[model samples]
Target: MKVRVIDNACRDFKNIDYTEVSANKICYRWQIFLEK
Candidate 1:
């Protein structure tokens, strides 16, 4: 199945911190770098 990543990421994101963020963001960042 396909994922509306940004929307799902936003919904799933729970933790937010200065040093780091939720797992969703980390996954997206990896996708952006790897996909690009």
Candidate 2:
């Protein structure tokens, strides 16, 4: 899958805090990124 890495990092578009994000959510975001 193609992943979009802005600033050479994966992040949750809706949430600004990376520390609070779960691994599953990050994986989900990656899926969304691949779909885009």
Candidate 3:
């Protein structure tokens, strides 16, 4: 799974890379997921 830098992350989080994110599964915000 690969993800691009769609938008910069929160200022508190810098130097964070895409691989670090949980890309293996369907990851999304709780609110957004519910809407779908």
- Name the runs in model 1 displaced over 4 angstroms: 1-21
Candidate 2 is scored at a TM of 0.40
Residue range 1-36, candidate 1, lDDT tens digits:
124654455455543442235565665775575556
Q: How many steric clashes between backbone atoms does each model show?
A: 0, 0, 0
Clashing pairs in 1: none
Error of 3 at 16 (Å): 23
Candidate 2, superposed: residue stretches over 4 Å from native: 1-21
Show where candidate 3 strays beyond 4 Å.
1-28
At residue 30, give the lDDT of candidate 3: 29
- Model 2 Cα displacement at 34 (Å)? 0.5
lDDT per residue, candidate 2, 1-36, as tens digits? 254454224444435555545545666666677667
Error of 3 at 5 (Å): 30
lDDT of 3 at 34: 46
